[model samples]
Target chain A: MTTTSTAPLGDITGSEAALRGFLAGLPGVDQVGAEARAAMLASRSVKTSAKSYAVDLAISMIDLTTLEGADTAGKVRALAAKALRPDPSDPGCPSVAAVCVYPDLAGTARAALGNSTGHSRVQVASVATAFPSGRASLETKLRDTAEAVAAGADEIDMVIDRGAFLSGHEGRVLDEIVAVKQACRGPGAGRGGEVHLKVILETGELGTYDNVRRASWLAMLAGADFIKTSTGKVQPAATLPVTLVMLEAVRDFRAATGRQVGVKAAGGIRASKDAVRYLVMVNEVTGGDWLDPRWFRFGASGLLNDLLLQRQKLATGHYSGPDHVTLD
Target chain B: MTADRPGDRLTVRKTFKLYIGGAFPRSESGRSFVVRDAEGRFWANAAQASRKDARDAVVAARTAQPGWAARAPYLRGQVLYRVAEVLEGRKAQFAAEVGRGEGLAAPRAEEVVDAAIDRWVWYAGWADKVGQVLGGANPVAGPYFNLSTPEPTGVVAVVAPQESSLLGLVSVVAPVVATGNTVVVIASERVPLPAVTLAEVLATSDVPGGVVNLLTGRVAEIAPWLASHLDVDALDLTGAGGADSDEPTGQLAGELEAAAAENLKRVRRPPVVPEDWTADPGMDRLRWTLEIKTVWHPVGV
Candidate 1:
């Protein structure tokens, strides 16, 4: 009854040789095929009861992020507040998975989440490893992860050095991911308590689906709890095609190693319709296991209000406007 | 019918495609319905545009609205004038298409084409002047100044008149875009050939991509979406209840209005019967899609 794509890994712990070999021998993705699959999945219709469920699911999966240079403690607090109750008027609205902030603001978000009257289900996720660019050395990167973890980040999102990955420095990317994973597991200063590690490939910077697929495998094999599509920095960040390739990789990786990894498609996904399409893709590609907030996430700030509006529409049976929703 | 003719030359058919973001594409559904000439002969297979197509067109129109709206009023006028010039150049081809599509005689078809081109010219002339006439500074009793200025209401969706074909379609679309608004226009269902040709003229003109995306399909099938789409700010249902429309037409328009209410969209309900497309499409068309914003400022030393 177990149907899967690609060969099974059984109980093998994909070591450097196996990891490298598995990655190197990883079948190249057909560009047109991947794109076509994404497009087809995007067209799946989810309406009425299903739509209500999806809008809530998408809102729940959002990482309510504010990663701007002008980010302040007040801003993080407001964002954390919104994360806990996206629609203040409607108590039925589910809280977001986490409030993502810079390493410095993780403490701010954590404090805000703690002080807020709402149930503190919302986690504080921080972008580490020099974020967007990942240009720093390993020591700086590890310290960055440790800093966010120490500052009360429940999840650590680390961006890979795309420059290295593109130039065939796979070992460097894998080593950094492993070290960052360890940094998240610290009490070693566990103030944050086993911060989940999310490896961001910044797929827009990675040239092709082949590189994206290889990067996905490399991150998962090196122990990424979640394989994220983008840093929300590059131009073509978190495209459906790229996400589709990554989702397929995770699906295959799980079939092989029996170790399930989550997938996060972040950036450029603004509207409820677009988010719904991504959910549909997840449902068909990864099935129900990855549907929860713990696995999937949308890294966006503007996206929350729209989801709130859509959620309100489902509640009131009429479309809601921007005036009705609180702006974070 | 031509099976008996052994040496007949194969007729070359033009594939009618949907114009979205200035690019001609077949419907995402890839399903097309046969559009016949007035004589009931197959004219062409117009793309049976789906909800997805309507959504895509709105996205395009939304994307282009800001840049198009920000253009200098005089520049927008000139660009619209350029569109008229393109249409004028293709007048002969358009006339022939309209003649066959609407079952009109050559002379009447030519007149319709002329009127359509002139309609564009009229709207183009209004682009720079409408704001001046519609907006003004309001004198305040207190030591303050208030100014009311007309702004384009972003993306507007138009269900083009099915009766008049070219002339009616042009009349509805030109005014919407003239006031800085971008539009996703649905062509006349039975007579879409001329509108498709008009789209070709628009694509070649200075109209930015997405400023005037065109979809050729049954309006009833596609309009519910544009009405419900949250991104679309205004809607012109001029083509909704034409002369050939039946009892359900009124209900359809009602449903559209109801859907538009979800977003509190500005809905323009046409007369029960199609308006005579050849008539002067006055300031009302332009006025419907324009938002008047009044700004108040304190008059301090």
Candidate 2:
């Protein structure tokens, strides 16, 4: 079931008390069970035609990311072009879903994709709300999202304030996500349609599986169109168990509330095999409904090249080398 | 001696495992094959390394290459020399393995063992001196001073000579590592006992764990993966085209050389004829595993 439009998740965010109670009342994730299940699913092999199909799906679902301090406009433009034509040699290769960058580079990425949009072109996703570390004030964070949205960013990835959440101020975190979500609405409604809001939990810093689950529900309840695992700036980013917990949260959230939210696993997902494992996890955990690029994505840079390499290996019946793929 | 000892005690047999990252690990595939001496007597079980094992060894070698290459040439020399010393101490065991695995007479096996140890020492001596011989300053007409130095070419995948297990394995491996290149060596399929024994010596010596990874399996099964691996910088096809190889020579070597062409890997084609291990292995292999880097610096007033 694709989400045609965002619907508010009841009145859970009506007040600080309601939001806290709802998040706290939400079931605690079983750490051991989650980890064991994640490990077990990771062993499931998707091969041959299934592997080829999974590679294409994974490539199309990638939010080709470049969020480095050293990233220049030219670099973002090149990355955008690379995203559009992943394998320049293979015209049949599908473009990635989006090109993720900093707020300032959203226009560059959008322009680099040329005139194509919707069906033919890649979407531009920008990491806003003082990304990596959501340490800025609410005003600045909202400004960050608005600027990116104004810069032609079709999607806004905003990092949650882990400090506020971990410090027992869940309401403040919810308010901040709501503010960022509102800012994702661009200067006026329907100008370029609704800018998708991806709430990044930076789950690495969230501490435990239970916290990851709570954070997932909190973002979803606060109108997050997508719940992301990490900012790729912290250690232990986007672990399988954490992702499993997030995926379970989304499944339950969708069932409970009638609204479907996407899941994005970022950081440390490099190998094609790992990407396939994530795909398998998606298929098994949430069923085939979330298998589409609209529902699941990988926020990565090196992963695209690996998927390309594996795709080539499958096509050529021999192992391929890094030389065949472009360097990110 | 205890006359009352309960029957004869059961002698313990060492489980030969693949040496990777300085640790003995069974094949990731959890497969082991029976190893029989050349006389057709069952000897022991050697790990039947899979492509995954070969890939892991490449990762280990790639990880160790930088630190091993960055070591002072004198330090690398001392480490390799120490390997020779360790091999000398374990010569009896290695010679026994060689005698059985290669169907050689005890004396001939001992001679092969001696030659292998000597070859290691020879390469150890070259570790410090090879750089001086291979690198030097170039006279330039411009104001810039140009100098060239030979650097290790990262990870090397070596197929050890299938016939001459000990001497041939050492011959190919020593030259590659002598120039600071870390190697993932596929030992002779028919005679892998001595290669595993040499891995023991490498483990005990000051040589880093990943500097020399030994894999005991079919060259056809492992060499293709290593040759095409993006991380592996070179391939030595010595064992692929050996005289006693199970696969037809040139077929395997040709395939590997072509796969290596994907990344333009520095490949040393196998010898046209089976090599005489006792003969000196000249600078060919050392040069094969090294890249010449030239640098220019402005001459200051």
Candidate 3:
């Protein structure tokens, strides 16, 4: 005797049509040409919340590329020292979110950040999952994630297997993502040790807007706390158009699942204008709710100076020399 | 051009069948619908594609993807160029079809046809050069050599533009196939005769069987299936619904977005204003056709 299963098949899921209808009716799609211009003008005069704007103003210094010498740990300590010092006159100066370093130096950076003047405010982020290039086996990647978390890193930046994703082995990529996320989970919800997982799609690698959309969804479905643009090791690493695509993915995912995901535009983000554009994109696509530093971050080493310059220009009404403010 | 005489009779120069899996066949549902010209006269009876036709087109596109992607870029360029050549030869036929369907003057219709052919040639040149401009070496900090390159995403489903039938169809399909991704294009429901004729050109242009499958049907019926198709990696809503009608365009865009949510299909939202067929090609096509691939080898190597 054969047992017949009475489950629905194909695209007959109950909520499919409704969800499609909701997406089609989204405020952005319905409004034609004039709506975009009107929205832009409306945003210009609107006052952003000061507390939220402060977070948006926070920038994270990533020192992954500085781990070149044999004394990698010592270099991390020195970098942490520089990142933690306070500017006397500007005590109200907003602090950087974290100093991102390699996995090996996570502990050292954590200790330095813990003891520095701004110890309580700074976080220590570590790169894991055979980072910069995720060519390792799934088991190896998971081990790497667990090891980084064990080393006291607050956040883990991991790279996804672009090859597997491009080759349509989406299942394999998703599986690896789930396993690594499992590794990040602990005994207690918040106490077991909370580590955020930033899944880097490296948009530069996923060539088209469409592929970027697919990869972004895949990463989110697999449980990424944040979706990042690039590893900062590729050309076309971060661009307004590519970031716009990812932002749309994030927006759609949230609408579909009612889950909020973070976006990080990394790699070649060097100037303030680029950061502002990314901010605009996030605000426009995901709504104003995700504009804070907790939801949006710029992974850069050089952007601080430009942001400082722009901030000074806003404050003193005069351009200051690069020497006027020591970002280091 | 003929005079606008009150006694002039509407005549159909061609009737079209569904092009699926590199073969022309009647709709599985055996359905046909009469498409009328601007004068409210029936011009032709075109295939009323069924859900099965949509699936069949998906199958054809999926089957053709590997070979097409693996072909030399220059060879792909040549095949696309050949499509333009065939389209140029039948310029008058397409112009006449557009004239009746869109209510454009004869000269204006011919110009639209010429513009469509020119659009194909422009995309043909991009087949070889897009990769160089879009993908390249990355400067990694460690002792590892890394490079990023673009590759074709597999099978795409396109909802061709309703207003500019031939040009819109070519604009959507050329970019997709130019980058080695196979396509299943849903022709304009109001004007599908030209879409079927273009399929004939694709068949003879060495585009390979199944590379570009053309289906003539109601987009509302077929778009949801294509959008939600698990095997279909990307869906383009470039030309579906009337741009003038917010109700239908919004409804279609939302349905496609939600269906695409299942597999997270990449969706190119329809443009508010139809793209100019004769204008220089923008990054819109390249943005939709490519995927990023990051490669790593040991530092010293």
Candidate 4:
């Protein structure tokens, strides 16, 4: 059966008018009915259970702000140590997906992870283009992206110039994005050396749901492998509402263009519950494909401990404070 | 089947104009564009609103916000409901216009027009009640009593939807005003005639001046101005989709969102599908309209 392209307005008019008239006559401030209340409660429970299971069963970490001043060698060694040491008792203690560090530290991370015995699982990602505050020139940004990828960074996180964007310089932003993506393309040794580019929206600075949606689409159209929320430098980074808005944008973009792009809610996400909420949003908004560590990674410094605590709570039927969990 | 019966036959047409401060006016630029039927017949010449026209509309919406928002909720609902009444009276004209422009059957066009008008009436009732539903006292662990209520976010710049021209424009404008915010709407570029007629209805109805202003022009030309306009408090780009492959709408949305950030202007992205119009209103509208107002009174009193 073919779907009708045109709907006759007259046919729907009677129903529309009756509905409108009824709505018009009714009191504006009526209480929500019991059915709706019950449905809301059930949905809330479903959402919470869905989120908890997602966080407990499968969720990975992407530690971006960890290798602050560390050199390439130190960062790689750190990543190798983390990747090789998964807890034996906890089935949920999967190794992290990647270790995100500064561009200069990409080679060290790559070599450490690649050469370590029984530790080729972790990928090395690099932040390029005057990250945290993307105020650099396009040429320098492009160069930064190329240098990082050439140095064995599998993924590149580039920040959009919030100042330029706010100034209504859309063409410039698009051009920068295109140039960086072009720089990251190439052929690797056995497989393609094509680096996944995560466009950092720095949503805290963008300030509104509308802007977040717009930026999410723009990045996706400009060839973003993943759309990231924040650089984690500023306050109010990575909010649930903001992530919800971005995920909606991804879903909309996919529906519009048939392209499935990933989302990364980085920065200010420190708790297992917060991670669970992000996971819930991703699952609900984009579905199960995004539930994996390969697609979704929490850019966090203190998130692992919280995840461990939640896991412990689930196992022992008792909640434990931060003191009981081990530190990295 | 009746021969020589002129009474059985019908003709439909529309006239498009710019709506400003509750008045229907031709574009200040004195430019007009012809909208044609699917058979390539001339239907109407719509006002080609200019940058100056957009800025002027913004001025009108800004000037009228405080008073319109201050009006009693029930009174505001009554006025908005009156708009629906006027629209219902002219439903035939809207149906005919849409039928010719969209190449749809008369009956189909009538349904679209009726749905659009009814959408206005629905939101009109929401004018007063949306506040009570979306906002309330926050459960804070503090001594200070805090109540959050919905408030107009001031003048908004809106880009009406392209495909469902009249319905899309009404769907956006009604919600913005239902919560007391004034708007400057940029009508659909390809089919703008119905928007102007709706503006006429608003003028005749008791809609406060500048509560809603309509612009008819190239969205690309006018959108940047509205997005970058420093005075505008929020933007709704629900109609930025074009036939072009580049999707300039997304780029425009980003630019405007970033620009709005300077003053923390609320922004609502364009809906991907027309169904989004009838779907549950996202938090975007609520977030934009609701404000955290902390009322203080002497506890002793």
What tens digits encode model 3's per-residue C-alpha lDDT throughout A62-103? 222343336477677766665554233455546566778777
Name the top lDDT candidate: 2
lDDT of 2 at A82: 94
lDDT of each: 0.85, 0.88, 0.73, 0.71
> Where does the lowest 10-residue lDDT sum fall in candidate 3 chain A?
A1-10
How would you encode candidate 1's per-residue C-alpha lDDT over A288-317 as one tens digit per residue?
888988778898888888888777767765
C-alpha displacement of A323 in model 3, angstroms? Answer: 57
Looking at model 2 chain B, which ten-residue stretch has the lowest summed lDDT?
Answer: B241-250
Q: Could you give the CAPRI-style class of model 1?
A: incorrect
Q: Which candidate order results from sorting by TM-score in descending order?
A: 2, 1, 3, 4
Ten contiguous residues with the weakest lDDT in model 2 chain A: A1-10
**Model 1 has how many clashing residue pairs?**
2
> DockQ-based ranking, best first?
2, 1, 3, 4
Clashes of each: 2, 0, 14, 7
Q: Tell me the interface RMSD of every candidate, in Å.
A: 4.0, 2.7, 25.9, 23.9
Model 3 residue B64 CA deviation in Å: 0.6
Off by over 4 Å in 3: A1-328, B1-13, B241-249
Model-by-model DockQ, in order? 0.15, 0.43, 0.01, 0.01
lDDT at A266, model 2? 94
Error of 2 at B17 (Å): 1.8
Q: For each candidate in turn, give its C-alpha RMSD to the true structure in angstroms.
A: 5.0, 3.7, 21.2, 25.9
